[model samples]
Target: MTWLIVALVLVVAAAGLLRWRRPAWYWLTFGVTLAALRVLVRYGSVMDACGLTVPAPRWRLTLARMTNRPVPGPRAPRILRFRVTRTGLVLRLKLRPGQDAFDVAASCDRLRHSFAMYGVTSRELRSGVVELRMTGYDVLKRVQMPALAETRPMRVPVALREDGAVHYRDYRAVPHGLVIGATESGKSVYQRNLVAALAPQRVALVGIDCKQGVELFPLARRFSALADNPDTAAELLDALVSHMQDVYQLIRAEQRITADVPDAEIAADIWDLPENLRPVPIVVLVDEVAELALFATKDDEKRRDRIITALARLAQLGRAAGIYLEICGQRFGSELGKGITMLRAQLTGRTAHRVNDEASANMAFGDIAPDAVLAAISIPTDTPGVAITGDSAGGWARIRAPHTTLRQAVNVCNRHADLTPDLPALAPFRPALGTLAPVPAPAVESAPAAA
Candidate 1:
């Protein structure tokens, strides 16, 4: 008994130390098991207290009385499986006859508190099965991104999801995305992480930083084209539109519809074409879209219209032409301009960081997911990078990007500088990074040319 007590004391001490010094380690060693046990033990009582249990069947009571035995307790959802994950416990439950998934979802908060878990969320797997993901701790409090494997091209792991999964910025799946956040909202750092993730891939990057290239110029080595002002941005968008049209023309010409040609070999978009003929895809990052949207004079208005029209066109038609848009701004309301709302409608993916107001949150997730707006607005200012990410599919999750500095991103950009594809359409606006402090111009010039 004395030996067991001493071992328990040692375990407690280790748990305390690890909880303070290394949360992830503590979670793996002690937190997961203890949380799982607590959840299993308290499952029935917690469900009953939270009104998630159905009343005992009258037949059971009648049988118990006839047998002169105690009546069975109310029926709680049957736990089909209880599994331990790195972050928490996942419980798969089979609903009782009178219960449904909604009952469990609505009682998640009570269940979370009863189980002493940090977070609880539920999703119905089928008509009768619901999965409860109960996080043992606040996963987003301290961001630690796991090493990413070889993901699909144009797909980059940008942040950690609340459920301990990687939140990927998949350009192919989302196509065009809108990111909204106020000043000091960690939006810039998120963008930096995204840039770093994409630098190693064989994709063309284009930046339109109307803030005189303050945000994107530092990592210009990986960019095929960059525009720092409204005028240049307008010209750049026109060039992109032209390039997209050129790609479509190429696809049309490549549609060699011979009877012998396999349907899979027939070209439609750039991906469908022969690998040798397929052009490098483009990922356009717009820093501070409001800078390009706000206009005071008629000339500025005309330029803004042209930019918006071009962006709308790309968002609508660029998916087939191997072009994607990542537009970031503080606010993206209809007040920005007439075509602004239409352009926003084309962006299927929406990510909102810590915004200054609920209105800004609404602009991002309003029509898509109303609950996400609340989550976006409620983002504590103390937690900088935490944001809500959702798509047109109407699902949203909280995510926080690892803090990445400008210098780190610049290094990745310079290391993969050779991968920058030279598109003839964007050559005129290509940013000259010769003067950047980190990389030498001669080394950049010495790299082998792209085909």
Candidate 2:
């Protein structure tokens, strides 16, 4: 008994220390309390009183009242499992008959209040199963993601979803995406995470930064091509379009519609082509797209149109050509002029960080989920990396990228500089690495009296 008491005291001391050092561990120490909440959900009148359950029949209520017994009610959703994660507790619930997942989702706010948990969110897992994520504390207050070692071709884990899952960008699945946020709103940080994640991968990096290359210039070593001004951005994008067309021609030549080639083996995309013949995948990162869109004169107008059209074409057909786009900007609206909306529609994946206006959030998620607009704008200014991310399917989640500094990302790119591929078509527009860091003047030696 004395040993057991000592052990309990040690456990409490350790938990308190962990809470002080890492709040994430503090929330995890409440596993027993989370499990007990399931009983409260099963027997308490909170679920029924809140209209979470179906209404009971009058006859059944009357009979129970006559006998001084509790009224019979519909079967409550069964808690099937508990997954304890660094963020919080995940409860898998099996819905009772005639119950819909939306019913639970709509009552999420009430569920948070009744359970006395910090936050609650729900998502339909399968036909009859729903996952209830009860966050004991706000995970976004401090973002820390587990290191990912697995490397899949053309995919990288970029952020952590609210449900304690890693959010990955699979070029083959989503193809193109748009990131919107104001300056210092974690947009740059998120981009750094992406570049760092992809630095060591066997893919080509191209950049279009029109802000005098302040953003992407530090990572010049890893970029196969880069453009730092409006005029240069226009030419680089046009060149990418030409390269995309050449790849399409290659695919056309490799395609064979014959019985000998299995239907699954037929070449429709770069992935379908034989491994030996496939070109390196390219990811074009556009920093501050507005710099590429806004025009000052007639000459600038023509350049803007060319750039926008090239971007639209890339978003439309670049997926099959082993090309993907990561377009980031402060704002994206029709006000940017022609082709902005069209380009947005083609970018199925949308991520909105703390923006200066609701309109910016709407531009990123209005067509997908209007609620996400509210969520995006609600992000506090203090939180740099919090964002609302979603796809065209109308599903959305809160995500945050682990803090990655500019120097860290630059180091990764420099470490993998040798991996940068050389494409003959892009050679002319390749980034000027020699100028990234100014070369020191050569030391002079006296000519030794003309000897």
Candidate 3:
């Protein structure tokens, strides 16, 4: 009895050691061996465990009779190879000859669901092939990509998604985007990440900060122009409009609308143009857009109208002209002004962070996806940068931009100052430095000879 106990203890210790040191295959083998031993010890029957009822001698013969014939020589292995990429994991699987890829893909959906619990999934890449991509990993979830993306761009690492894979997207093709969030809801951090990512690229940065440029002024070295007031914002938008017109002219001049050249090849925008002729793209960032819509008097009303009109124009025509808008605000609704809804209509890309008001959440996604509105409103203040992002392609994704410091963004911008472009029209609206002449001190009257 003591020897039996010792033997059982040794078996458990051996199993533990194998489990700790060996790969998954060894653990599976150990489990199968243990199950076999249990069956033998408890039932004293190997045939019963194998689901065999025939006598031992005839059991092998019966199994052979039930099995089908083998295939031709050099049978291929059924396995797929994959690697985790920045956007997602990439799987490469070769299909068996005469096998349907679609059937395999449909079958993989169940596998994808099973893997989703661990942040992994399978997606069909092409016929006769597939990729095991990460659906939502947790580690790289909060990084923000640049607006003007490049082919095979270097990925900026952050935390992984819930699935344990990198998280990223190409924003250049996404064009314009709206970021709506309540105050202190981490929207600014996301913006900082976005700016830092784009600073190294050869692109124009424009900022409209109605909060006395509090949010964007620190990064002025990277911005071609920064507007602090509504009037200044108007001037900046006008200048951008002029720049858009120039870019449009350039595209038209280089337009290659021909039967031989496909629409994809036509030089319609900066991206579509030939590399040598393509000019850098421009990204316009607007902070607290509500200020541009607010008015206290009749004069303010007229100014708001012009400002909204210019924004609407930019939203309408600037996309194809290589100018994109990243408009952020606490609230953006049709009730804000006459052209507010009109402008919203043109902003195909939408992102809503945690918002204080349901109206703001509604403005961000109500027109497009009603479900997204619910998601936006449900976001808690504690998770600031978490947002629902919808693109023009009708696909929506939940993303959390990384927490980027204002000082880090400013430093990045300053380091990349040489790339900043000169926008002649916007130059006048730039914040004046202290070098400007000081106002004359008001003359103080004597105390009327001590009364």
Residue 251 in candidate 1, Cα distance off native in Å: 2.0
State, as a TM-score between 0 and 1, how close model 1 is to the true structure.
0.88
Residue-by-residue lDDT tens digits, candidate 1, 1-451: 9999999999899999998888789989988888878887887888889998887888999999999999888889888998887777888999988787888889988888899888898989999999998887778888887765447788889998887777888887789999999899999999999999999998999999999999999999999999999999999999999999999999999987899998878887888888898989999999999989888999999999999999999999999999999999999998897988889999999999999888999999999999898999999889999999998878899999999999999999999999998999999998876653675556445677799
Winner on lDDT between 1 and 3 is 1
lDDT of 3 by residue, 1-451 (tens): 9999999999878877765554233324564444334423432132223221223334445565678533223222134674433343444656555555554444444444433322434445676675545432243333434334433321233212333333443445556778888878778887887788778877778899999989998888888888899987887788888888988999999889878977778876777888787766778899888999999999999899989988988888887787888898888887797998888887777877788777887787777777677777887766667777765554455667668788888889979988887766567765443444789999998676664
**Model 2, 329-379: lDDT tens per residue?**
999999999999999999998999999998889999999998899999999
RMSD of each: 7.4, 6.0, 11.5
- Runs of candidate 1 with Cα error greater than 4 angstroms are 1-7, 54-74, 96-98, 148-150, 256-266, 435-451
Worst 10 residues of 1 by lDDT: 436-445
Error of 2 at 158 (Å): 1.2
Q: lDDT (0-100) at residue 141 of candidate 1? A: 86
- What is the lDDT, from 0 to 100, of the residue 5 in candidate 3? 100
